[model samples]
Target: MTVFILVSGVFTGAHVWEDAAARLAAAGAEVHAVALTGLGGPRDAAGAGIDLDTHIGDVLAVIDSVGVAAGREIVLVGHDYGIHPVLGAADRRAERIARIVYLDAGMPQDGVPALAAVLDQSLRARLAERAGAGGAGGLGGVEGADGELPPPARDEWQRWGSTAGVPEAALDRLTALASPQPLATLLQPLRLTGAAAAVPTTGVLCNGNGASIEMVQLRVGVGDPALQALTDPRVTFFELPTGHWPMLSCPAELAEVLLRAAAGEGHRLEPAGAAEPPVHLRPFLLDVPEVPRERAGNVDLYLPDAEGPWPAVVFVHGGPLPAEARPTPRDWPTFMGYARYAAGQGVVGVTLDHRLHDVADYERAAADVAAAVELVRADPRVDADRVALWFFSGGGPITADWLGAPPSWLRCLAATYPILAPLPNWGMVGSRFHPAAAVAEARALPIVLTRAGLEMPEIAATVEEFLAAAKDCGADVEVVDVPHGRHGFETLDPTDESREAVHHAMRSVLAHLTA
Candidate 1:
């Protein structure tokens, strides 16, 4: 197999791909690590004139030199910002290109510029400010030789650009070799025909930094055209455990993945822990206010004072009551208090009441929750990618669909002493609220179920059976035991133990969001 690898933006050159290239060569594939113009040491007046077309020409020139022929396909790979130009080249040389692989990267939509499409509005404004402040030949006003953009600030790069697993030696080398990015490259919009669309594509996502392919899907969904281009059915998706820079952290594994893509066997990702070690949540900000909403079923928003794209949770209260007795969003004082607590802890908390006039109303509750999710995602304050569901008491089974086959956006589910099974008394026979059976359907999505030590016999037995069955099925689930507690302890019993249990469960859910 013939392969071409393009490195991410704000980097030196082909040196970043050394490990991956060497590994590919060892695997009997011919690899080309092409350096784009105006990057690395081939600096011309700090790359004042280098743009998207220049970089595209650079890859095309490499392909011409490598000499592609019929039946000898080239596997074109790009990481981060490098993906933009690679897409351009792939479209032009569609015949010789067998596959296009994007490594923790974004794809080009017809008219969107690379940077504008990738960065959120806030971040884009910041970048624009910095660029405008740059000096002559520098991006913004930050200058480098030959008019190139300057590298990121040390603190910023350390926090966001680098990862934990990379060796210190590699970090030092990267820091030394890192070059300034060119302004024109990011500002230039890509032009493409249908040729690249016709070629097979694979998106090899880097999940080491707590960002997964599912999270990316949630971030844009099928709604955003740019994200849809990379996530459509024609593209294959896989996850890598290393941070954004997999070439430096897990070269051998990365090489094997590329080889598999070349062989038409990269459709499925390697099992989560087989190729890369899994990550768990660590206690960080175990750490929040209330605001009322008038519309969307009278939902109330409890928010933190801090600016956020904060991980949010939809708190569903339980009540299988008559129409008049049923609580509206304005009611549920206990849930509202909990939502306020969540806001203080930097989470966007929503306490919305679903219809519960009859036993069968639980089915409609799911639809209500879905609507809430869409509403929360549209808010600028919430991190749509890291949202979760929290069901209390009767609300538990109502969210069965979300628990079993959750949308990509849901990070985890927390059921506080929930009524998970369809009880003989509820009078809803043949209902699909069997959480035990639904465990397998969740795949590996994280779930936290809180068990009240002192529970009614029937509910206790059902909870036990569900936990056992979930374990047997290898589901990623855990039980938070609240010994000496009764149902709704978090809200009803304000003792130290009950408070601690609620806090612990909330923290765990936050950890899952980050993970």
Candidate 2:
């Protein structure tokens, strides 16, 4: 297995992984220990720039190189603050990775960040008394026997960046680091809801008790259940004896566990170790879901922070079952993230549930999406000309054929792992479902149809047919197999390929919208 080792907390540098990586390599595994933008004791220009994305991209560049020669999946091990960029890297390279192993670091225990997780209950109360002095949140430490403790220097942010152990020399390395991290990583809520939930992760907790500090904090009622990274369904917990600086004390054990996980032979894997599943509190589900308001039908909308009101995209939830049959949150988070990403580049994202009629025609659902867009735009926050439409699975053809008819005011269209065959059972219906009609006013609009290996045969054929039709009518059409996801990737946990496909394609979508 290939392992990417990332240093997250305090003073980090890929140098830290030298020893651990050597051992893993001897065991026939590859490991890379990397530092984030600012914290690592490196001159910024001396190495790669320090922007979070640059760091993520740096890792991706390496993974891409190693992937060309690998046999199994890649395993990413991140420490502390490193999870963000490592995850970002994983999100963009979901296809290349087999699993993620977080050593002495993982997502927070609850709503509170990891900083809050490590501090014991009694220490927390004491810190609260000192809240006026910036408290624990400030990263300020009391003057110690070693001399004055470091105050939370605004530039030395404990918010966007963090550290656990660092020598004085590494502190000098920050002079040439890149710009500080964007606030979104901290203040922004990570919405792993619906079909877009992230890949599963394992946390190897090291510190005081065998229990993770996050778990300990939770038992004391100090955090929100959802914020805890441990709640992710793919999560498996293990304990190690050591402090937060495990690379310094227990590199061998961390490497062993990481190798085991990549080999899919971890001790507590599923039925091998029966226990309660992580209590998921996100908008999505732990099991098959039941929609509370079946008849009324609700739609979930995600807006980008940078875009106005929002340039909304409506997702027609795809399913083989009846619309009344629960579809859970559908693709809200995935669609939303893509939309918000576009919005950050200046667009909006919108998703809606459709009604399945007795006739079972899907255009009705398309019309419903069209109507939802109009309604969403009616709100001051939405922009009509900037509107885009997206769909997955069965919803794929629903929107494509729907667009065939009197095309609504969509500026662009994006379809992923779509199934595009025209059903004889569903009528021409002459509106959004009529492909011939939808292309009539197509002088300038752009259409992106993304096909993947696991895509349905008919859908691929239909998309091929649609591309010819669009080009004949003078519409812009780009068809590519960017996301190489497996069958049912829409439901399976995310992979690096999944993220790179979505993000890269989305950049195109957003750029077209703005241009």
Candidate 3:
């Protein structure tokens, strides 16, 4: 239960961390996003004159309402203006927090107002213009008292308004509203103290001179963000080459960096590591003569245990071919993170050499999955009520069809990045191997689908199709979108949460079998 709560800076919503949040989940950390009060969206009950404490209180109430996990410490991240609110949260719930990260955030001290105390004169003057009519005189510094959105400055902000390249409709909605700030929050200095500084802190600075570190530093008289934090023992820093938002421009890379910071895991850019050498392919075998073997039609199987009977989890590999041709072993030395985890959790793992099919004809492939399931059930230890399957990448299509109409041996299904062949895209016509049909048959069972969070946007449509299939089939679907993670995350050293999620999905199916 390692929780990472990310707070947004001014003029942003939880949507800001959309990319990075997904990546963190893929890397195995539990992540949540935060919206500063009066920033992302209005609190239903919030009114004007909402001071800094109210904002901090707003965020704290959310944390309390959701409730932290049982034992792990939470990580608090504050960006720009959000520093005040998180610091206040830490003051009250420090025990729940393990570390605090600031993304070029302002540091406020006791009895000090947040905005006025940190902003340089240049920023203050610029802000004065945007402050409504009544806000002109309220501003502390040098500009004449007219709080108006100057055409030029407003235009500049508008240009860089969105991180996801922004949609025109959203841009219109945001531009329609000009936010007003409370005089108290603007004038009051921050209330930082010795106690809070004692906690762990990390800073990420954008050296590209965009909005976060560079832009602010350019306006305010300060050096780079990471360098500034170096003097503080509690704070660690890193520089990313981007303007303001790294999530929009480089989600995958940034997510890796965040994951490294969280798990203390290895961090390599796949420099020489992206692809394995030739001969990375080979046949993977499961059953051993030492262990009791269950013979089923020319196939020798290894059941997890020989007690009464345990649920079977037939593992399918991608690349349509015979097991001997492009063999898929139960435990592959090259990479079997998924198998290692599922098997460790007591699932009777089965590795199959699949049957071939026309490149586009999935019905043939679907039939192969059916045959494999039948072969699996022939074993004595395979509990008909608890049997499941874990299908990898391209193998998903075959297994998806099996789940829709699998033998009694399969009680559940786990598909990773399966292709919804029923869809009309990619020149595909009405598919005979419509997974929706099998879903209808297996509607009563639990199904877990894992997909990469940062895949092509078109994948969303594919997912929608699957969701429709699940709904039509009356199946229970638990879709875990691994954020910032690429396809085939099973091969990597994912975060604990990511692995746990998969395990939980498996356990749920197993538990339901008994229930």
- The per-prediction tally of clashing pairs is 17, 25, 21
lDDT of 3 by residue, 291-331 (tens): 34444543345544436566666666553333243223333
194 in model 3: Cα distance from truth in Å? 2.9
| Model 1 backbone overlap count | 17
List runs of model 2 lying over 4 Å from the truth: 1-297, 330-333, 336-346, 357-359, 400-402, 405-409, 424-441, 487-493
> Looking at model 1, which ten-residue stretch has the lowest summed lDDT?
277-286
Compare candidates 1 and 3 on lDDT and give the better one.
1
lDDT of each: 0.67, 0.50, 0.53
lDDT of 1 by residue, 222-302 (tens): 123335345445567777766667888898888888887777664433232332212111111112244533345546677
Candidate 2 similarity to native, TM-score: 0.39
Candidate 3 lDDT score at position 150: 20
Q: Alpha carbon lDDT of residue 28, candidate 1?
A: 77
Better of 1 and 3 by TM-score: 1
TM-score of each: 0.54, 0.39, 0.40
Lowest summed-lDDT stretch of 10 residues in model 3? 265-274
